[model samples]
Target: MSPRKVSLMSRILVYVLVAIAALYLLLCVALFVFQRALIYFPQPSAYATPDNVLTLPVADANLQVSVRPHDGPKALLYFGGNAEDVSQNLPSFSAAFPDQAIYLLHYRGFGGSSGSPSEEAIARDALDLFDRVYAEHPQVAVVGRSLGTGVAIRLASQRPAARLILVTPYNSLLELGIRQYPMFPVKWLLKDTFDSAKYAAHISVPTLLIAAEHDEVIPRSSTVRLYGQFIQGVASMKVIAGVGHNSISESPEYLKLIGAGL
Candidate 1:
C-alpha cells in the first residue's frame, strides 16, 4: 500500500480503537453507578401478587405462593411475567390444571417478597421453591412466561419435572441486551444473561414451548430460535395466532395448547 494510504488507514484504526475503549470504560462507570438498579429487580406495587396470599419463606426473603389443585392428581408450577402480578393468573391456572395442584412463584422484590433480585438469586429461589413444592405433588410440571423463563429453565435443568413449558420465551438476555442497548457493549456489561435456549435443549423432560405470533417484547423470531434449540422428539412448539406477549394466556389457542400439553 502507498505510504499516504497506510497513514490514513492507521489513523482511522486508531480512532476506532480509542472509541471502543472509551465506550467500554463508560459502560463500566454507568453500571457501577446504577448497580442497585441492575441488582435490585424491583417491581411496582401495581404488580403485587396479593396482600392476602400465602408466603413461603426463603433464605433472606419470602415468596408469595398460591397452591390450588384440581380433580386430576397432577401438578403444575407456573412462573409469570417480569412485571406481572402472579395472583392474576391464579384463577386461570386453577381452571386449566383443575385436576393438578399448582404453585405460583413470585420473584424476589416482587409481590410481597423481600430482598433484591438478580439472575442468580432468582434462579436460586426457583430451584429452592421447586424442592419444596415437588415434595407435595406428583407429575409436577414447570411453566415459565417471559422473564421467568430463565428461572424456570434453570430449575427444570436441575430438578425433576414431568414437563417443562415455556411461553413467549427468548434465546437469551444477551440477545435482548443487544436490542435494547445496540450501541453499548452489553456482553461485558451484563451481570445476568438468562440464556434459556442454551439450557432448554439439554433439559431432560417432556417439553412444550409456546410463542405468540405478535409478541411485542420478545420478537417471534427470538422465540422461534429458542424453540428451535429444543432437542427433537422430547419437545414441542406452538404459537397463539393473534396473541402478543402479555395476552398469550388470554388466547383460546394458548389455553388449548396448555390443555393438550398437560
Candidate 2:
C-alpha cells in the first residue's frame, strides 16, 4: 500500500500492456498481408486458343484480351474466380455449350492481364466487357462465380443481361473482412471488399443464384440474403444439396440446373 510498492506494480502493468499492444499490432499487420489466404483461390494457367481467337483492347488500360469465340449466334460473357486463370475453364465451357459464343474475361491480374486486382477495377472491367459483348451479341447472358459475383451483380445493375448467373455468392466482402479482422480497422484498411447485395435488387434481369448447402467460403446466409433482396426484381435461386462451395459447380444435380438455366 506504500508509494514505493505502488510504483513497482504500476511499472510492471505498463510493461505488460506495452507487450500486449505490440502483439495486437502484429496481428493487424498479418490480417492485411495474409488476408488472401483466409479465402480460397486458384492461380491461373495459360489458355491455348485453338479455335478462333480475337484480341479486344480496353481503352486507357494495358489489358487487351484474347477471346476464343464459339461458332454460334447467342453468346455468354463470364467473370471467373479471383485467383482463377479463367482460360483454364475454356474446355469445360466448350463442352457445356458448344453452340454459344463464350467470352472468358481475363481479369486485370489473372490470366496475364494488366493492372492490379481492385474491386473498382474489376467492376469497371465487367461493365466494359459487357458493353463490348452486348454490342456484338445483343442477346447475351452474364455468368459470375465466387468473387466474380460482385462483378456480375454490378454489371447487371448497369446493363441488361439476358440471363444472370451467380455461383457460390456472398453479400459483402466488407462484412467478411470485419469478421476476420475485428481488431484491425477493416473498413478503412481494406482496399476493396465488393459488396454485391447492395445493388442486387436494382437489377431487373432474369437472375439466377446458385449456392451449395455447405458453402465454406462465402456463407449461405449472405447468398440467401442476396437472393431475398432480389425480390424487387425477377430472380430465381437453386441450392445444391450435399455439396460445399468449390464442388457445387461440379455436382451432377447442379449441372442439371445449369442446363435448365441455359
List clashing residue pairs in candidate 1. 70-98, 70-99, 71-98, 71-99, 72-99
Tens digits of per-residue lDDT, candidate 1, 1-262, equal 9999999999999999999999888887897467547534555433233442557887778877655644454778888777776767777766766677777777777776777778888888888878877777657888888887877887888898888888888889789878977876678778788888878767878888888888888987788788778777878888778878887788878767877777
In candidate 2, which residue ranges exceed 4 Å CA deviation?
26-42, 50-54, 64-66
Please list the C-alpha lDDT of all candidates, in the order they appear: 0.77, 0.76
Off by more than 4 A, model 1? 1-28, 31-52, 69-73
- Go through the candidates in order and give the C-alpha RMSD of each one to the true structure: 4.8, 2.7
lDDT of 2 by residue, 68-126 (tens): 57544577777877776777667777677776788887776555566666778777877
Per-prediction TM-score: 0.82, 0.87
> For residue 214, what is the lDDT in candidate 2?
87
